[model samples]
Target: MRKTALLIAAAALLGSVSAQAAEQAIHIDRQPWSFAGPFGTYDRAQLQRGYRVYKEVCSTCHSMKLVAFRNLAQPGGPGFTEAQAKTVAAEYKINDGPNDKGEMFERAGRVTDYFPSPDPNEQAARARFNGSLPPDLSVIAKARGVESGVLRGILNMFTQYQEGGPDYIYAYLTGYGKPPAGEELTPTQHWNSVFPGHKTQMPPPLTDGQVEYTDGTPATVSQYARDVSAFLMWAAEPHLEARKRIGFQVMIFLIVLAGLAYYTKKKVWADLH
Candidate 1:
């Protein structure tokens, strides 16, 4: 009877501790994404819309340095045609090199050129944004870490929940709203519920009707967030589909080879047995 009471007391203590932790923890909302599971592929239209959001809104502060202009036309990516990509590239002026006069000059960007930085250097970027530098968006989606607790990890393994990056991006982008009544914000800080500690250096960048979507999708902030997040994910993992396909093929090959080996061994051992 004493041992049973002790076990019950321990259980109640654990329950109270868990309840307190839950009350103190920040909850990040998960967004629905197309490219989330093992067999997932990017939505081409959505990627294009995302690219538009990036070009019009996010590009003002963030540089996608890792992606070249030509990558837009690559297969299993944003599905931009060669002509379309070239047209897009022509919109930006790229720094080009030494001519007969051995002087650097500006030229229309080509497929070979990487996306240019808005600011000349880190110092300039920081100064422009009130001592807070805007991060390069090329891999920002991948850079954000997922808050996968023990229970979430087990659930994700079965659910194939690989949208942590994009989901976090979407949540964070849409998370900006009016602060709580008593919450005080510094002059340079903006309130974002999804952000760590609920404060961010960057202001809310997106608003309704910010970018005109060519495909007639709604220009709401929510849509913009989702599309841009998806685009960033594709930029970070351009070869994702190809990698998955190759991995699947390898698994199939191994299975077939194993079956053949098993049959051959059985045949060889039949006489000995």
Candidate 2:
């Protein structure tokens, strides 16, 4: 069986779909996303803001199944106080156990609990998204669409192309389609992407200065999206810091091992040669 990595952990929450604005599709104005050699790490401040953004903005319709509140205080994060985490955790609750009559009970979440999802399973997600499953964000950065490098998106026999790299994500988010003033939206072209490309369903989830990044990060719309995307990527893969550290240690040991092998080979070959 193919192993679909589902536990990577990630972000976003949806709201009432009825709240969407009129179908005004905007064109892709500029390239925005990049991944290769990206300099997108969320220092403590950015993560804190990103966390706030997720909770206040994106948590309604989506779910983050992998992260618990306690993870916030790790090596390179906001380090929320236990009291702070509990306050945040109490915002949601889950089924605790059963009553004598066999009904489920409820309790506020502790920092140790995973996030409560809006829906129970894929069927619920599809029902919520008009039949499209909202992809889990845990590993979305790595699960990047192949067309991520294309400036517009994958070659559509129908429309323009995507620019490659992180700009792909950047363009897609900002690319909400705007009708040409006169034309009404066709059902096919109805929903506008905040990013330029129509392939994305997410609206522009950021605003100028919506998030206060004390890390001196830019507060532009695109900058917020980029930072939050990076933040989500890191949350989905919290082991990355340890992974990087281990990789460095392994590489050093291999280098030393290689040097020893080379010297032994030279010593053995000296008499034979």
Candidate 3:
């Protein structure tokens, strides 16, 4: 009986594992990003287009609370001029408080102010979305990532493939579609091929020709997804280019130091030998 029980437990555990594997069997194809690889840098034009997408669409629900307007004008970023950033900041109204009247007041946003949330508070946001709080997009590209299979993971280690987060974002953005036959979804839930459990509270956020692009870039859903994904990546790591440059410099310095140390060691041991 004990042996029989063990067998049953083993079978149950195996079944659970199989179920989990099936649930996690999502496949997301990797995308080529401008800021990928050790020596790669961000494309300024792409970043700018991405910012437009985020501002026009994603910002309606998601907040980028960690990013300040001044960041838009920083070096190694979207390449916006300080005046342009300031102008953009002034377009938004910020809530400030406690003047002589001891009451809250609304004022034009400043360069230092972070992006405002669409809802006033967490509770308000949850209530507005029927208990689903829209996530902040500040570091979303860093927070979300996809797993490569064992073989690909091993290869990624050598290739320095750290764009999984952006790839997942891009896939998720484009993964929306009609549910498969016999699949039931709640009124609020939507189908997403890349999302876990194939259901998401957020509906398809993009449509073809929804956001206009002035620089001759296509205004399609795919283009919007790619642009916004890249922008989110930049928002998550504003100093990525600088970090890569410094890392490369440090590597060269280490190589030269290693060579010098080898020669020094040989010289120091010559007489002893």
- The lDDT of each candidate is 0.88, 0.58, 0.92
lDDT of 3 by residue, 1-273 (tens): 999999999999988876776665578989999899999798899999999999999998888899999999999999999999999999999999877899989999999999888888889889989899899999999998887666677999999999989999999999999999999999999999999889999989999998889999999999999999999999999999999999999999999999999999999999894
Residue 250 shift from truth in candidate 3, angstroms: 0.7
In model 3, the clashing pairs are none
The Cα error of candidate 2 at residue 59, in Å, is 1.5
lDDT, model 2:
0.58
Q: Cα deviation of 264 in candidate 2 (Å)?
A: 1.2
Clashing pairs in 1: none
Which has the greatest lDDT? 3
* Stretch of 10 with least lDDT, candidate 1: 20-29
lDDT over C-alpha atoms for residue 123 of model 1:
94
lDDT of 1 by residue, 39-67 (tens): 67889999999998998888888878999
Task: State the TM-score for model 3.
Answer: 0.90
